[model samples]
Target: MDKEFKLASQLLTLLDTEQRWFTLAEIEKNLGLSDKTIRKMVEEINKQLPSTMTIEVSRGKGIFLQRDGRSRTVSEVISSMFRETIFYRLMNLLFTNVGRFSVEELAGAMFMSTSSLKKLIVQLNNNDLKPYKLRITYSTPMVKGDELNIRYFYWKLYGDAYEFTGWPFTKINFDFINQLITNIENEKKIVYFINSKRRLSFLVAIVLERVTKGKSVKITEGGYPWEKGAFHLPVKALAKVLEESFSIELLKSEIYFMQSLFSLSQYHYYEGSEMTPMKEVELHKDKEEYQMGNRLLTLLAKVYPNIDVKERFTLEIYEFFDKLLIDNAIPEWMTISKSNLTTYVQKECQQIYQEVQTCMQKWHTAYPSVLYNDFHLTKLTLLVRSSLRYKSKKAFLVIGEEFSIRHYIANLIKKEIGDQLIINTSIMKGLTDEMVQQHHIDFVISNFPVALKTVPVVIISTIPSKRDLDNIRKELLL
Candidate 1:
């Protein structure tokens, strides 16, 4: 056997007898090996060890062997190692599933020497993925060009946490597949994006068709598990998949945040869990005050250089911003004004005014524009008619500014509950107070003070804070 394997076996025997944690120095001295050898041995052993058996290194302490209680017997340990290796390998393969890699990186990741790993890689190319056996095309005379691109593609398509439980061994034909992906990019046939779920779903279906060949396909890491052959896998895998698929090109769109949030939410839902408060908070925090809004304002400034500063401007600009998020238009809006209201409409609007006008044309074709000169001056109570349009007896109305975070949260809740949700501006009307007292509203949410005593009220804003709510709650009780 190899000398390294022999030394590893001897070390394992000693550790079995010790039955306790051993310091690095102690292991080094016992084996009569240098620190480098010991470290290398540790890494090698980790790969060979069973999943049930973990080699842990404490912060100040040394290394110790702990039983996962699941790993027993040499075969079982070996199987676990292979499983983990397969998991990581599959993840890497999926990363390059988009296409681009060299045999060298694939060999290194599989922990096999170039020659041995190549054989295993041949199996990947020859052996079908079963139900869906994918045939990959490699560029001619592959030496080394941009295999990293393939790795990046897989990462974008899947995530780092992806696994190929369906396949054994980490060995994958990354070089050949990377070449295929590069071709796909050059062809510009594959439309990789987040918002156009319909288009993206179609593209994914096409990819699956080419690879799976009507075979049983499993997409682990956040996809619809019941999606016939596809499976909703994990979060980490999804993140990586998105990174590989979209690359830096996706950064140019305005709906980047929404697309990112959708991906992030999908990953969290699968890998983490639904209703994870911390994750939800983190998602919102990341989207807080994106520079896009300010950028829009800058563009607005250039187009309507001397537009009136009426609240009408704010409402008009807000409508334009709404379309930007909805349509996912990414232009040079980021470099425009990004400060506040003035910056958003006067500056950003000017830059993207043409794009906005173009989008408005399409929207107007589908639905007639609400003829209103002054959106702010319009009574909030009058908008209640729009809320009542939803086919629900009870409704939760959240009233706030367009930029208010509460508005987004309320929209989410409304979508989930399918309630007749009303979103009103900050201004109040005569009937607004009466509507509150009547409790006609299931929930009245306001970021500002209101005399309305209608159904229970919720004030959602950062300024007042929850502490302030306590006082308001008491006042309502009185």
Candidate 2:
């Protein structure tokens, strides 16, 4: 077989035994196929394979190989789907990174004419699976010859025009822009800060303009860091706009320009700072940290969790912030960070114990005899505390029924300390999920421990029953 065909076959072989889907890029990397070769091979395979089998293309998403004997292959139906061109890939990269795009920026990224992009966008919109839609409109000064900077585009895109236009050229609606901004901001893959600034500036400007019009603005009582400019607009007008548009109540807080500066500095620091922290890691315990010390691990994992963290950290800080503020108290325009977020996370973890202890004490007072017992109270306290600050807090608790007491220890962990711990009792007659619907299990526990850590394995006699062992082994094959 040719190299690309050989690679495709190898990938199919690898996939045949498993019951999980993979993205196109992943398959290409694993099989060592260039984009062109892979697409050609996939097309050939589509014609050759049974009607049930074909390559599934998710435009702007990715590709997957699917086999369903029962259904006429959707891939076949969409087989005539236009092959993704270089521009498609380029546009996907840019648009997927930042939700909205200006003609200039889009042209720059694609290295194409602005007019060409606009034409392409029109064609793209007409496609059956038009994953992205483009909207373009320009606002000239009611006065002529006004210099149009980046802000001009921003204002136009998010200003009153958004509401009027539909399809190819719709007016910019702030609500839609807000939704787009929120979606892009939270996404892990795209971190386009420059575009983000443009988006945010528009939202801030709109909010500011309403307040200045002497309209009724509702400003919250407690101050915020970004409240100075917020006050420039009338409180009555602000409140009305916030309530109507965002359903948020405004709070009185001065903007922390210094903190913003620091955050910006830290962003740069994070980009270039590969320097390891001065901390020794006990490899015998959490061996994954041997390559990089604990200090580096903590920084890398927390700050850039998506790319860096092998383990996922459950952040309930947003929930905490939500509770701290009154309804709609914090606007999207406002951003805040702990003085030192890294240190803050560690300190907050430490404090969970005290917080839990306080709750337990409340339980003690409410039902004295039931909870007052020292053993129960202590166990509850430790469970709560340990759950928060547990070493490898981000990793799973792998429970193999070993005579070494580790299995029993994991059980004790659940019995003593609940909620914060997820005991993946996979070794205990673990009914292997063929297609482990990840949605069913807690992410913190459901991950394969072997992939999560690199600790040595001594497969002791205290292993789970043969059936359970077989099941775990089979699942590992996937």
For each candidate in turn, the TM-score is 0.20, 0.22
> Which portions of model 1 show Cα errors greater than 4 Å?
1-47, 50-119, 126-133, 138-247, 251-478
Q: lDDT, candidate 2, residue 42?
A: 71
* Candidate 1: tens digits of C-alpha lDDT, residues 1-478: 1356547656665665655888878888888998678777878888777566756766557777776544464433433343345434544453334334456665565676767655544554554221123333333112121222222233232321222212221333333333433333233223223233322232232233223322221222221112111111222233245447534121212123223222322111233224343433332222311233344445434433443434334333443333333222222122221222433343323323333454344433543422211121122112211122233334334445455665565555445434334444333355465655454555455555655554556665644443433333332222
lDDT tens digits by residue: candidate 2, 342-451: 34333433343344445545534533432122222233333333223322222134444454566575565455444444544444333233212332332223213433
Off by over 4 Å in 2: 1-198, 208-216, 221-323, 326-478
What Cα-based lDDT does every candidate model obtain? Answer: 0.39, 0.37
